[model samples]
Target: MEYRKLKDQDQDGDTNEEDVESLRGKAISGVSLKPLAAFGVSSSDRSKWKRKTIVTFALTILTSSQAILIVWSKRAGKYEYSVTTANFMVETLKCALSLAALARIWKTEGVTEDNRLSTTLNEVIVYPIPAFLYLIKNLLQYYIFAYVNAPGYQILKNLNIISTGVLYRIILKRELSEIQWAAFVLLCAGCTTAQLNSNSDRVLETPVQGWIMAIVMALLSGFAGVYTEAIMKKRPSRNINVQNFWLYIFGMIFNAIAIVIQDFDAVANKGFFHGYSLITTLMILNHALSGIAVSMVMKYADNIVKVYSTSVAMLLTAVVSVFLFRFHLSLAFFLGSTVVSVSVYLHSIGKPRR
Candidate 1:
């Protein structure tokens, strides 16, 4: 298959040219045609390739759709609820689900019980540190969300890349390339443009505090990723599932305590069991998925790539928020976000594989 594709590429020397023209024709005709001839795919393998592409594209669309829904929910007047309680409950549920998932994977994969437990414990212990930081960040974020709109929060979130880059250099002794730095700058500019032109006013009273909290949250998340990578490097054989399980366990405990203390007034004001809605449920699920995604990336990919991917996620989040949530965008945001995305992608490609 590979040889045939290479041969075809060499022979035609204009495969791209042909493909572009074919695509244009297809667009103009607006009729169904065989995939094989359309893109020079061999008829014998066209079905397989079509299926693979469709599946991959479907999954991407699904994931992005879920993200869009979550962001929209936040914008649709869901921030009125108490952050601490909501996050604590969500984290707790996620931790429990993660533990269950690890157990099932261990059983199926035939991993040693002792190793699983040890790895699980490591996850439990380490997760809280970042969770604590995340909790702080989320609280600030929710506050910001309450004050500003989705676009502003999305833009500010790009600060994570900058924060992560600095922390990685300090903690992991990892240096980013010029391209990576350029991407970070672009992402920052995009975020700034989005925020500056936002119709929502900063309201001076809370914007500064929110900004401080958001930056702190970004720094904490960055450090958490670096720390998790360090831990994973030391235990290369450990399953990511086990590591994530323990991290969530520890995070749950810490977050639970913080929630109780910080939201004491809200709990009293709204009663201990307020705001248990579908939105909260979805938010918890989102947090769980995020934890799983981060752990898997840290375990399997280069740490630099892992951090850079976060920037990609941010950019995607912003774009989705704008289009789906009807958030505003500006030229500065376009140019800046483009720079950040390119820089991050370049850095990821340039990174040495483990």
Candidate 2:
């Protein structure tokens, strides 16, 4: 969904601009030099980098898996569920799991009950903004699924990197070199190549409506991501558990509202579980779990890691898609893919700004 694509984090939004500048430099340098991410930090910071790396890899897998499942479910046919219902269930489950996590943290850490409620409330007050963004993003992505296939979805989705970079410059007042811009351009080109030139099946020839949704999703994801990162940097000490709980609570609430608005008629006419299946349940669970994984990565890592992970996931999705979607490859797809890979690698390993 657009939620994963957006990299949106709910709760907490503050940052020491000076520290952000310092850390941003390191994040980019580390990413470029090691092609791993955030390596410019000293040994003292290695622990954090390690934490981020593990989270990045995990989220990458989870994110890609969710994409795979969505396409797989679509192809399976003879079974489906309301997109709104699925999104609502996922958010509800996510919120419940977050509450469970909060309970465990409270028990293990011996925090007082009153303080916990206060923490959660604090997060709710701040996170609703991004949570609402998530509401729209989630709905948009579901609509996108109706029009585009999995591989096309993945390729077009990588455009989020370009969106992120543009937002980074405008919102954070950061500057990028020509080289950095070129890499972003290369990513766009590769995704376009895969989408346009692929002799692949129906997924590649997404309708104009689908293209519009994907582009809008990318731009929204970019804005939402930068906003979330800024919030985390602003308040470095915020409790992630508290933040996540409120984030999903708001998300669940918003999705419920959307359901009432959009699905109420259909649901009342046909009943809520009319098209329910084990696959739908699994997809709901998949979305809920993947949401947590992404939030972790977005909080612990930076754009470099997130983009790299998303890029890798896109590649995997495209490769696996050939078998799953039964589409043939094209030369332009391979050429574009190679160019994208090389560009991302070179940019990551490029010399850090003086």
Candidate 3:
């Protein structure tokens, strides 16, 4: 009789313990049984997804609301003091506060020595790049705002979304669905409508240098988002408290450099120790709160969703700018903004439930 090893079966000829253990190990180790599935989400699921849908909707609303509030607070006239000097001061203070917050969290949580040092280095290296870029961006934005009004600035800034989307697709190989693409197009249309001939009355003949600087600023903001996302993914479980703590430390370093370069005289005249203007105070609070909000949201939500939420805020700002500032509101502006809003809504709808 040919002694064939009878397929590791039990006495009843069922699959034996060895076979069962092997299968379990594969599952436990993340070896998928289904080859065709993407991101481990099977196509067969239908009734199982109701909870995810509800949760995503709730999170989206929360994210959009927070963004709107932050934008409003930042744009409020009280926070719009002399843009360059005030922004540098605000960023410097924000960095200081953020580092303090991080240290408090670290002391409470008792991080490992290795983790502590790594976290410190993260802040040291990453914070300043974005801070300086953002300072420059804000400076250019205010310069533009001085000439063209808030509505125009809001419209132009929406172009950041376009740039971001392109970068994501090209650099990250993240693919968007057809609906998402349509949403982006609609957003562009809305922004165009919102800005079309909106600045006819007050053309300040803004220097080409300013326009270049503004575009650079917008690009930096987009790149910052991408870079932050990348960093978070690399260490998914890293505490936001620690990350933000380091962020502030590095931010302070860069902001200090910026202050010296841009506001040395202002600091000397006002006394470096007593430079707490009302605008600077609001900005510090704004940065601290907004940083926390953004870090938490990014932890739970998709990057694209976060980006789109800013679109909603931009739309609100455009509306507020027209009515509150009494800026021009032509038909083109209205139509474009409407299209962009619709696109944003559609994009929000199509976002995958986390």
Candidate 4:
């Protein structure tokens, strides 16, 4: 990812004395690069930081709003429409968007030898793997709301950070520092503390089934994220829109199959859009945008930025839930969220010194 000093090199691959002299003059005119270098900030690093900041902000908004909208979209305890159908619709939308972007690229860049292999099955076959994994993880997103409220879901979702770290190391052969390992332990303890309720007899508000589903969802999310990252990184030169198109194409296929298997009779009895409302439409848009945002994060930024953004969203969701859903902010929830926030910071900046 490092960029060489293009201005200092000529077409003949030799140093340009004129360019060096020009830079030297600029330095003489009170434009020294030493101050920036002193802080270890280069032009490339600044560019990267800017991109990461923008993507992190987008992720924070998309993630927090999506969680809130999902909870609000539910009527009573269940969704009137088929969850599988909804997921299928989201994937279809994403595929369309990615295709449109790819078409724009083709129009401007022209289809050449570089992208000729983009759509072939041999090149795109790995997409379906993460697509299927995402299908399961997304379905659980809707189903888990049945057991826990919005804030509780936000807190529990952090479990994926732990699972992601494990799979990221195991599958990608990356190394985590000892501090990051302790941060994972702290994250688990924070989630457990969030679930504690002094007023309830059972201690935890979420049922056993809810915990099971949450664990399964975390595992699926971790694996899908790591796998998708692997696929994207495999072809570092490939356009991300092409990758997104294939992934979403397979996502739509898998979700369609799920709809047929699980909701064929119900959809036949009513309709695909039978119980959909404005809230439902908004939820669909939120999910579609969220998926696109996550893909961009994986492509442009690393998962550490994603973790920080989602961690901020966790707090944002809890705050929004208080006014919208009348969610009580308990002492345990505060302490737990504080701990979770600390864990996230520690994990993000806990890398070993070079």
Strongest candidate by TM-score: 4
Candidate 1 clash pair list: 123-246, 123-247, 124-246, 124-247, 183-340, 186-336
lDDT of each candidate versus the true structure: 0.53, 0.64, 0.50, 0.66
lDDT of 2: 0.64
Question: Which is better, 1 or 2, measured by lDDT?
Answer: 2
Candidate 4 per-residue C-alpha lDDT over 1-354 given as tens digits, one digit per residue, 9 for 90 to 100: 000111000000000001112222344455445676689898767555555555567768977887676557542344466666777777787777777666666677788664442577677778888767765665676688788765576557667777787887888887778988887777767755655675433325799888899889888877777887788778777766677777777777887898898889989999888777777677777667767777766766665556656666766887898999988888887887888888888887898666
* Per-prediction tally of clashes: 6, 6, 8, 0
- The better candidate by lDDT, 2 or 3, is 2
> In candidate 4, residue 179 scores what lDDT?
89
Per-residue lDDT of model 3, residues 216-248, tens digit only:
756766676665555444565555444555555
Cα-based TM-score, every candidate: 0.64, 0.74, 0.61, 0.76
For model 4, the stretches where C-alpha displacement exceeds 4 angstroms are 1-40, 74-79, 112-117, 134-158, 198-217
Q: For model 1, give the 10-residue run with minimal summed lDDT.
A: 9-18
Estimate candidate 4's RMSD in Å: 11.7
Best by lDDT: 4
lDDT of 2 by residue, 1-354 (tens): 333332232111111111122333456455544433354556536557666766677667866776677677666764634667666777777777766766665666667543264654454566777666656666686688888866567667666778888888788676667787787788777766755643455655788899889878887777777776665555566655556666667677877788799789878888887688877777667666666666666677765556667666766777887887876777776877897797777777663487
Q: How accurate is candidate 3 locally (lDDT)?
A: 0.50
In angstroms, give how far residue 183 of model 1 lies from its true place: 3.6
Arranged by TM-score with the best first, the candidates are: 4, 2, 1, 3
lDDT of 1 by residue, 1-354 (tens): 211111111111000001112223344356344644778767546544443333233323433444555665656554455655654554566556656665565666666753465634434545556555554554454466665556455455567667876877788886666666665566555545544553534433446767786677677667666776676556766554456556656666765686577778888888755766676566555544554444544554444555444444545766777766687766766776766656656655654444
